[model samples]
Target chain A: MRRELTISDQRIDEQALGKGRAMSAGMGAAVYFVGVVRATEEGRPIAALEYEAFQPMAEHQFHLLFDQAETRWPLESVRLVHRLGRVAAGETALWMEVVAPHREEAFAACQFIVSEMKRVVPIWKKAFPLA
Target chain B: MPVSVLVLFCSDQAVSGCYKSAVQVRVHFYSYFKDLAGLAEVTESVAPGSRLEDFLQKLFLRFPKLAAMKKSALVAVGIDYQAGDYVLAEGDEVSLFPPVQGG
Candidate 1:
């Protein structure tokens, strides 16, 4: 089986997106979330946001999150992709999809996963203001 | 014994009649911490049996600014958040950062 959780320095590609959302007949709901980098940080203009991570730890934490969500909800498929290095403003920084048997499970699990990620994930962002 | 006592005697023997082993831990700083720490990663000597929670306090000697964020700092031993009481050992990779947003 392929890895459903990943952290990459390259941009999130079409190939990755294609594989994550594949659903079986048993699944009924899918929640897709995209988090973009804004053009400003602290109300000032910025060129881009530079992202960095302890990749090995980041991947491990995501898997833990996936496991936690699975036990709480009837999940069918889950995919989470986080971008590293410099991501331009208005570009994607993170993308996630949670699929379950019902919309309620999908939404709850997605929110739980993202909330835990923000609290525990070892990722950081730096704003390189326009210079 | 708490590592705090050993830390005060770090310049002493490793395991003499009244001493204990000291360890070197690899610590990685992130986000604002990297800037405050003035370096990405460094190997710091830790008193034998120091817990992960004591890391920020121990590290403050070198990077005082980082300790200022202790109330808001985030620490982890790999993927899991290690509490202050989680005893750390040599060869451990620790990440110390401000509240984070990755993974």
Candidate 2:
């Protein structure tokens, strides 16, 4: 299966993740990363964070990141789901699943994808400070 | 000047004299800018061959507060980020986003 990348306003589905399990024989590790919306931002208490994305472009950028990761690591599959609209503090803002034959590459590629995703993804965040 | 009216007063010498026609760009704002602009999208006109920066200057003129984000804003036409010097074409769907803080 190919990389599954999505940008949506709904909450992330935790149960329907890591579908690449069937390929586990060839892939030894599945690294999952979850990015949460912090209770405070820049030292200020926050009620929640509002996330928005240029959908088409955000998806495009994530594809590029997937491509980048492929050349750098032998991966079985990649999955990324970023939330939109309002996300409460301590909630999942992002969820990523990276599958590879080795833990090193699985971890490295997972980190690389997130780093590159942050750099180029056309996703924006607005913090709502607690009054 | 209202951004809608400023379209007719383009400063780009490349097409300044030719006021007969102009390129219309559909602009969409995201995130911080979406709220700042108070509207999801708006179509703006600019001189033929006008660069993205030229159009942004006019946009800032209409919304002085947005000017503060001029340096940090990200511009994209279609699905790719575009440089300020990139020339805009007719009917282009332009998107402007403030510095992203996504994870």
Best model number under TM-score: 1
In model 2, what lDDT does residue B75 have? 86
DockQ of 2: 0.59
Task: Pick the DockQ winner.
Answer: 2
Clashing residue pairs in candidate 2 are none
After superposition, the stretches of candidate 1 with alpha carbons farther than 4 Å from their true spots are: A1-3, A14-20, B1-20
DockQ of each: 0.56, 0.59
Per-residue lDDT of candidate 2, residues A1-131 (tens digit): 46888789988877777544445578888899999998999999999999878888889889988988999999988988899999999999999988899899999999998988878898888899887
- Against the true structure, candidate 1 reaches a TM-score of 0.85
Where does the lowest 10-residue lDDT sum fall in candidate 1 chain B? B3-12
Stretch of 10 with least lDDT, candidate 2 chain A: A15-24
In candidate 1, the residue pairs with backbone N, CA or C atoms under 3 Å apart (3 or more residues apart, or in different chains) clash, namely B53-B84
Model 2 - which docking category?
A: medium
Q: What is the TM-score of chain B in candidate 1?
A: 0.74
